[model samples]
Target: MKVIADENLALTDYFFADLAEIDYRAGRGIQAEDLTAANALLVRSVTKVTPALLEGSAVEFVGSATIGTDHIDLAGLATNHVEVTHAPGCNAQAVAEYVVTAILTLQPERVQAGTDFCLGIVGLGNVGSRLAQLAQRLGWRVIGTDPNVQLPEIENLSFAQLLAESDAISIHVPLTHTGQHATYHLFNTQTFEQMKPACLLINSARGEVVSEQALLNDIAKTQRPVVLDVFEHEPIISRNLLDHLALATPHIAGYSLEGKARGTQMVYQAFCQHFKREASKQFESQLADMPVLFNLKQPLSTQLLPLLPQLYNIRADDQALRAGLNKDGMVDAAHFDYLRKTYPLRREWAAYGDQSF
Candidate 1:
């Protein structure tokens, strides 16, 4: 068997080499011609897999080693008789930590423990729900909005209510273009105007969830601090947006080593199941010595601001993105991809559990 896979999928060969010969390719540049001899395909979000993309190819199974499916045309792939599966919640911890780190960086004043600061979560899926749990545990009043999902503990608010009431809003919805609650450009001018004054805005979800021009205008008008890990025109993002953002990253919010390894493990199991082969139950990256930078003897709420930075200095990510883009003021796709590809994978908070304080 032959497999076409994304070079970025961690442990792609370690897991699949025994099963098939792998043809690794850059995700964004993967094309139909590469699938001619492939029995299975593995991808990250950058590659768009439609039935059209699979036409005349002998590919059967396709797996995305990421949580979201917006980039994949599910119905189309199924209609073409292709077995499709994705690793949902694989990077939930990574993304949740990213949001928490951003919040502490942007508005640490609002997140003191046992506090009543309102945090509005716009989705209740894997990533959003995990974020809500983290924020609530940190003593923030967490409210969520997802018409199709209801977390009994989290007060369900309408999208409008979330906008009007939240002290800081973190977007986690998928980029949908249809349905009653289509999220495409969901945070446009009208919605932005409805938001609480000086409310922090975060979009680690998808770029199209907020209209770029509308966001640019809103930033100018309200001077609201914003954190964006994803951009509408990603890779070719707006430098103006970069200038105004409180924190910006090259869509590496979910790029943790553990997360990537989990995603790869999930897809490998799925591949084994589909092909009727036995799968290994134990999987994950080996551990390293994770040192706690500060004494955690104090109340965590009082020190989250400083503690999280020591664990993962989010500003370093912001500066790196800005440094590359600020050089020529031109859209550099290669540089953007380079940042993600060469990103030194950060370990989640779980890794620090065994650390000697």
Candidate 2:
């Protein structure tokens, strides 16, 4: 069977080796003609899979190698008999690590042990659950606010309570428009006003989850630090918000090599299950040739905070975005997309977990 895939997807060769023909194209630039003759199509969040894109196509299956399915029109695909699949929880660890990095970047003093430092997780799904575990391990009290999910040890509070108590807040929910608990514009002026003045907000979930205009106005009044890895209209982001943010990245919180590879494998297996074909288990890559050693003079107990920078410095990513601004002093759409396409290889934190301090 012929398969058309996103060129930016990692390890495409390992999964599509047995296919008749594997056509790779830019995700946002993929045309309807590209899918008109293909049997299957694989894409990332950048591609918008709608009825308009598949109206006259022979595409029977559509797969996205990403955790969120907001970009895919599930109802439309189901009505047209086009099976859809997505990779959920594949990048949970990567995003969790990114949250930890963001927290440390925003407030290093809060990284110390104690219940005084509390972390509020918006959604207790895959990414948020992992982050809660990490923060708990680092000696922070974790309070989650997902009505549907409840953990034994973690305290599940209401949104208002979470805003009032949490020293730092990280959003991990999906972007739902019509649901009773809609996440779109969840963090508006009132929500921002309710948060503690020093509360640090980190959003790695979805851009539209928080209202950019509201946030821009709210931050001016509250002086709250906001870190965003996703935007509402990606590639076409607001310069006012970008300039106001304490930390900003080009939506790459889950771009770790292992996370992306697992995403590709999950979608490929889903495609195989749809076609009743044997899936390959050759998901391997040479992204990391050698171990990244971190040498510190302090005790291992006091080394975690200092060694985190060796693993990944989020400031570099923030700087890259600041440097890619357009001539008009706004973020360039092409430059934003270019940063993601040519992102540096980042291995998950688990890669160096076995190393001695």
Q: Per-residue lDDT tens digits of candidate 2, residues 110-155?
A: 6675688999999998888888887776778999999789877799
Model 1, global lDDT: 0.85
lDDT of each: 0.85, 0.85
Q: For each candidate, how many residue pairs have backbone atoms clashing (under 3 Å)?
A: 0, 0
Off-target runs (Cα >4 Å) in candidate 2 are 282-301, 354-357
TM-score of each: 0.94, 0.94
lDDT of residue 264 for candidate 1? 87
Q: How would you encode candidate 1's per-residue C-alpha lDDT over 54-127 as one tens digit per residue?
A: 99898889999999899899999888889998999989988988988888777667666354688899999988
